[model samples]
Target: MTRKDNSVARLYRLAQSARSGQWNLEHDIDWSRRPRLPFWMRRAQARKALSQLYHGEMATSDLCEALLADATEDRYEVRSCLGLQLQDERRHAAAYQRYLEALGGIDPLDDGLQRALTAARHGPFGNLGAMLAYHVVIEGELLRLHGVLAQFVPCPLLRDINRLVGHDEARHVAFGKIYLPEAVQALSDDERRALYAWLEGLWQDAADSALNRRRANLAIATFFRRWLGGGWTRHAKALDSLGLPSATGREQAA
Candidate 1:
């Protein structure tokens, strides 16, 4: 789909990054950093933060599972790369779940987050459709917010966890970086319209999920702006790099 002869080769590097990059959540994180909540302390925000991260990641794990389930041997490089993604997402989910259990217990999914995941799952965004929603839209915003939250979130364990998650997410999003443009290029007109519709719904739910958190105002804004087309010119450029039209520009032209 790319104009360049080495395009798929560049995409192969996604698998390479998955194979060679990443860390073991258990061995890498020192769990002792989990803060002990005192009688006088209300760790409400911290609890919510870790809890939301855990649930969101678990949903991503499900998406990864879908990817794995649909994989075939013919698409060996791409499928194998996705095989690594499945492992990475599960490890991420487990690490965050462990962090939440350490805090107390399951924090449960917010209505908005659940809504987005469900929409992506039950609709045309199946397979590659879901992958774009996950990697391009969701993972892109997550990478940005995690970077900020890593610096600002209070708990040392949560902060470091955010940092670690961000590192892994960068590689996942790297896959998106190489995949989306070509995938978009291959889309039929109707398919592109469907992609835009799915993106609108996904972006809306993403914005809603960040609301009502008093302490996460900055993070919320960052997430919202990303969904609202702020981080998207960068996304548009990724498509342009493929010598294809940007999905956003196409939608506007349509």
Candidate 2:
């Protein structure tokens, strides 16, 4: 066979192996029995709400497929990384499914998750780079927020679930680091400018989501009350740690 044929074969094999590794969602999670609830019912509810967000992984995978199909010829690595990300998201969704099943077979399909996905799909930065930035930068910020929430939850089972989801998120951030800069480098000056503008808009959206007053207030009054005793001050500190601005400040900057 020709050398070019060999190269294609190798790449195809690598892609197959990577995809196969991420296929079994049930095998990865230890769903031996139902998890016990925490002392704070609100904290339990928050966990349930967060788990619902994972239900949108199918939508995310479809988006990723679209992005990958549009990837330039020289971006094979980026495509491979996106494939891995797709697998990880599927696994994450499965893990969350198990957690939800444990919680009285609840399926979390709330307006919040739907709104977030819709906003992302319709964002000013509608290209691959914008999607990458949102996943890496924006989702990375959300994972940090999840970490804070996990700390506040008294239930060991819920904390374990958060940690598992966080692990997958970290992998996604790594993939973003791999592709985002390369994507930036490939763009024209105008495209770069548009991307930067998109980044700014996405950053504002993330800040608003993080410091969502109603959500924050509900979190504090319920599950996160122990950690956020100082109220908005503590919450602001958490947002700062994640490199996010307060919602009010983000609006002002806009």
Candidate 3:
């Protein structure tokens, strides 16, 4: 088998292994324990941010389903990995929804995240761009966000959720990293440029939304800014590695 074939085989193995690694929401998280929300986190602004995150999980699930629908049988390993991720995303959305209910009912999805969801659902790009946008960019940022939440949130239940979800997200991102390089080699210049444009807009929308959220809540401004910086750096590196145009430098300025 070629190196690309080996990578796909490995991804399939990882997906199969993920079956046993999965945690049950009802059993794994100790719901009996009391959840202590920090004073600042209890505000409406914080709740809104959490609501956006919850909605993101739902959006990810939807995107996974879309990706799976378009997947062909030729790429068995890749399709299997995506199928596993689809299940993971659904469970993540359910977990986040329950967590939101414990804090307060879910809020309306933020405009930025809502825009992202729309793009993921109805983007003009082909399969490669969709995977790059959803798996590499969105899920990559989400992996970092899960770490941030796990570390910052005092509640054990929330920490557990982040830990478990982060593990699955890491696998999803891994699939993109392994698969995209080969797929990108097949793209025409025009297709690459189109994808870069689409992803640029997606990145900007998310940054603008995050900035708006930060400005609205003074208490978490530092956290938001730091998160944005990390996300920009991650995007820059991913773009460079993928041989795509690096627009994150411009995003950093904005």
Candidate 4:
């Protein structure tokens, strides 16, 4: 594919110029002020919410390391894009941890989460498999969950942080949509089948998560606007571009 026609190449070009930080967790956000949340949206809600965000960011961190290990070092454009994404993931982890601290600390990620992340680090995760899992599926869920959380979040600090991180996530997912198709196209049939198995399990986990359990309790169906609606439909189109039915984009998220 030529530069213009190649989505991943275009993403690399875009990432080169888009490397500027959109917001500083220290200066941009006024950390001195705590959010004035009601009783219901206070500790329990914050704990659940922050814990989710924290784990997600850390998982992305691990996924990035795996990607960097396998990605060609000579092709600095792709590697550079992933490097910037790594910075974003680390920033997100810091922001979430800080937010949790601001709320007097939130619940820790479960042992299951720790185990899963550890297993992923050791497991034979395929090349594009990491991209689709981390950037495509997980990042899409992050955007959706944040959009939903923003609507109900009473704290000004959290809302502002969400707004800033939300911008970063949009760009992150954009990179996934642009890059994954080309990456997956290069994968062998066996690799694609392995990825398919992985996604099937991922969808099942999302369906069973605490967030999905409470999704019915909330009035604001958050996934519709961007993730499940037009945005991810377009995203799924990118996955479909490879003509790999074995690893189709599954429509399930927490």
Best-fitting candidate, scored by lDDT: 3
Give the alpha carbon lDDT tens digit for every residue of 171-200 in model 3.
Answer: 876777777877876877667667777887
Compose the digit string of candidate 2's lDDT tens values, residues 101-209.
6665655565544555566777665666447545744464456556665665555655666666666665565554443444555666566555555554554554454
Residue-pair clashes per candidate:
0, 0, 0, 0
TM-score of each: 0.77, 0.64, 0.85, 0.75
Q: What is the lDDT of candidate 2?
A: 0.56
lDDT for each of the candidates?
Answer: 0.67, 0.56, 0.74, 0.65
Q: What range of 10 consecutive residues in model 3 has the weakest lDDT sum? A: 245-254
CA RMSD, predictions in order? 4.6, 7.8, 3.9, 5.7
- Which ranges in model 4 have alpha carbons more than 4 Å from their true place? 1-5, 71-73, 111-125, 188-194, 209-254
**TM-score result, candidate 2:** 0.64
User: Candidate 2 clashing pairs?
Assistant: none
* Model 4 lDDT, residue 104, Cα: 81
Better of 1 and 4 by lDDT: 1
Error of 4 at 116 (Å): 5.1
* TM-score, cand. 1: 0.77
- Candidate 1, residue 139: the lDDT equals 65
Q: Any idea how many clashes model 3 has?
A: 0
Identify the candidate with maximal TM-score. Answer: 3
Q: Give lDDT for model 4.
A: 0.65
Q: Write the per-residue lDDT of candidate 4 for residues 201-234, one digit (tens) a residue.
A: 6544543443354467455345332234454344
